[model samples]
Target: MARHIYVHNPFCARKCPYCDFYSVTDNFLCEEFYKAAIKETELIGSVITEDAGTNPLTDPDGKDTVYFGGGTPTVPDSRYICELLGAVRKAFNIASDAEITIEANPSSVTPEKLTEYRQAGFNRISLGVQSLDDEVLKTLGRLHDSKGAIEALKKISEAGFTNISSDLITGVPGETLDGIKRDIGTFKELGVKHISTYSLSIEEGTEFYRRYSGNIEDLVSPELERSMYHGTREYLQKLGYETYEISNSALPGYKSIHNSSYWNSCEYFAIGAGAHGFLNDLRYGHRDDVRAYIEEMNTVTYDTYKAFLEGNESFLKSLYVEERLTREDKMREVPFLRLRTTDGILLDEFKKVFGVEFEDVFADAVKTNLEKGLLERKERTLRLTRSGLDLANIVIEDFL
Candidate 1:
C-alpha cells in the first residue's frame, strides 16, 4: 500500500549542538546499519508480497519515491548507499520517474560521492546549508563555512542534480534579515529548486538548550523571529517559489514527493534506526539505538515474523508498533496534517478517503476558526488564513 520508502542514516560526521534528531558520531556502525536496513527491507517485502499480485507499487503511476534522510546520509560510503538501494529496488517496483532523494550535509558531500549517488538512481539532493553567513553558521555550530556550502551546492548541481534543495535556518542567534536574503539569493543563483526554512528551536538535551535556556534573550526575540519568518516566506513567494507547506517552498513542480506522501497520509515503508512508517492500521518503527536495531534485525525468527505478519502484534520484535490507529484517530489526523499544505484540506477529498464529510466531523473547530478569521474556504479547500498560518499549532491542534 505504501508507494514511498524512507531510510534513516544515524551516523553523523559530528553531531551539531542544535540537532536533537537521533544520530551518533560513530562511523564504525555504518556497515552494520546498511546490512540491517537491507534485511529489514527483505522482511517487509515478504509481508507485502502476500498482498501485491504482480507489482509492489500500489500507486496508479507504478512508481515509488525512496528517500535517504539524516543524520547526514552523505557521511557513509557511497557503495553502502548503492547496495542498499539495489536491495530496495529488488523489494519494490521503482519506475523511471520515481523520485529518489538523499539528504546531504555540505561538510560531508563531495563531487565523487554526488556522482555515485546520481548513477545509483538518486535524482534529488537536499543539501543542508543551514546558513550562508559565517557568523550565523558558526553560532549554529555547523562545520561548513559559507564558502564550503556554496561550493557544495555547485558540486551537487555540477553532478547533474536538477532537483536540488538547500536548507536555511531562520531565527538563529546571529542571523539577520539581510543574511536570510543573502542565503535565498545564493540558493536561487545556484539553481536550487527547493528551499526549506526552519525556525531555530532550542530543544532540551541539545547544546543550544544548555547555552540559551537560562537566558533566552541571547536568541532573537519573538517579534523579531515572527518578522523574519513572514519576510522570508513573502520573499520566496515573490521569487516564483510556491510556499507549498508551512516551512517549505519549491520552484514549480519541484516539491518533495516523499515528504508530500507523509502529509497526504499515504502509507510509506520505513527502514533503519529511528525511521517510522504507517501500515495496516498501525504506526511502527525500530528503536533509535543502532546496536539494538542491528541485533533485532539479525535475530528475528521465521516463525515470529510469520506470526507478526498474521496480525499477532505480540510477535513484533525489533520493529514495534508505536500506535494502533483507529478510524476516529485517522479522521482527526487527516485535517491536522493536510492543513499544513497550501492546498489545505479538500472537503470532497476528505469524504472520499474517510467515507464521511469533513464538516460533519469537525464542524465545531471549523466554525470556531472561521469565526476567528483563522480559517478560510477557498473553492472546495479549507486552508489556513494568513493569521492562521502564524498560529498554526493552535488551529491544527483543534482538529487533533
Candidate 2:
C-alpha cells in the first residue's frame, strides 16, 4: 500500500560526465533487468500483504504515483517498459488517476516511441534537456543540442503529452545570467508545464571534478551563481510558474505528484538496481551491480518471498542494504523535508507523528531564524523566506 513507486532503469545511451547515478552502457540486458524488476515487485507485494494489518508504511488505500526514473527509461525497448507497468498493476492496487511518469533523454525518444509509452499508461514525461545552449550541452556531455531538445519536446506534444517537465542545470562552467534567461525562454517556447533546475555539484569521481577540481571560479563565479538563481526564479515566477519546491517550478495544476511524495516523506516502493525505498521506518537500497541483480533475482521463487515475510531477512539482506531510522532521525527529517515545499511544515501533522508540539522541540531554532527574517510562520505552517531558499541547506541544518 505504498503511495509511490520508483523504478530505476540502470542503462543509459552514454553516461554523462557529471552524473554519479548507478547506470551502465549495457543495452543487451534490458529484458533481464525488466524481469528482475517484476520479481522484486512480486516480493514487495507479498511483504506488504503479510504486514498489512500492522505495518505503518502500508496504507489501506492504494498507490497513486509511479515514476520510471533512470539511466534513461526510454533507451530500452518500449515492450519492456509496458511489461514492467503491467507487472506493477498486477502487484499493487493503482489509483485510477495515478500519475505515471518516465524520464527520458531527448535524443533517445521519438514521437512513435512516446506514443507507445502513452499507450502503456505513462501520462507524464520528464526530458533531460540539461541546458539550452549547445556549448553547455557539450560541457555536460548531453547527446542532444538545443535544437534537438526542442524538436523532441515538439514531438512529445504531438504524441499527446501535456504534462511535460524539463530539467536544467545552473552553475555550469561559463554559465551566465543571460544563458539562464535563454534556457527559461526555451522551456516556455516549448510549452513545458514543469521545470526542475539544479546547481552543478562536482562529485569526486566525475570528469568535471577531475578537470576543474580547484578552479571552479573559472567556471562560474560564486556571485554570478547567486544572481543566476534569483534571476531564474524571478523570471519563471513572472511567467506564471510557481516554485512549489526549492528546485521545481510548475504551472497551475502541473506539479510533479511523484516528486512531491518524496518531499512529503511518504512511504514508497522502489525496485531495480540502485533504487532506494523507505518502508516501515527502514530505508533500503538495492545492489548497484546489474549482473548481480539479474543473477540473484533469477534464483528467487515464490517460496523465497514467503520466507522473507516470516522474519527471515537473509534473502532481503542479500539484495539490499537496509537502515532502520530512529525516532530522532524521523523527527529531524520531517521539518527539513516539508520546508522544501511552498506549503511548508504543518504543525498539526508534525505533532500527530512525533507526539510533541513542534515549537516545543524547535523553539529556539525557529525563533532565531524567524528573527533573522529567514523563516516565516503562518497559522499552522512554517517555511523559508525568499532570502532563506538559496541557503536552505544551512537553515535546515539547525533542525537536524
Of the candidates shown, which would achieve the greatest TM-score relative to the real structure? 1
Model 1 weakest lDDT span, ten residues long? 53-62
Candidate 2 error regions (>4 Å): 50-63, 303-313
Which residue pairs overlap in candidate 1's backbone? none
Q: Estimate each model's TM-score.
A: 0.95, 0.93
* Best candidate according to lDDT: 1
**259-374, model 1: which lDDT tens digit per residue?**
88777777777888888877666788767889988987788766676565444658555677788788999888877888998889888777777788899899999999999999
Give candidate 1's root-mean-square deviation (CA, Å): 2.3
How well does model 1 score by local distance difference test? 0.85
| Model 2 deviation from native, Cα RMSD in Å | 2.6
Question: Which digits, one per residue and each the tens of the lDDT, describe model 2 over residues 1-400?
Answer: 3457899899999989999998999799988889988988877676666333222332323348889998899899998998898788767766678889999999999877899999988999999998988888998998899899989999999999989999989998867778888888878888899999898888988877788888765687767788888898899998889989989999998988788777767777778988887766767777788888888778877777556534345775445537667888888887778888888888887887778988889998899989989899999989999888867888899888
Q: How far does residue 165 in candidate 1 sit from its true spot (Å)? A: 0.7
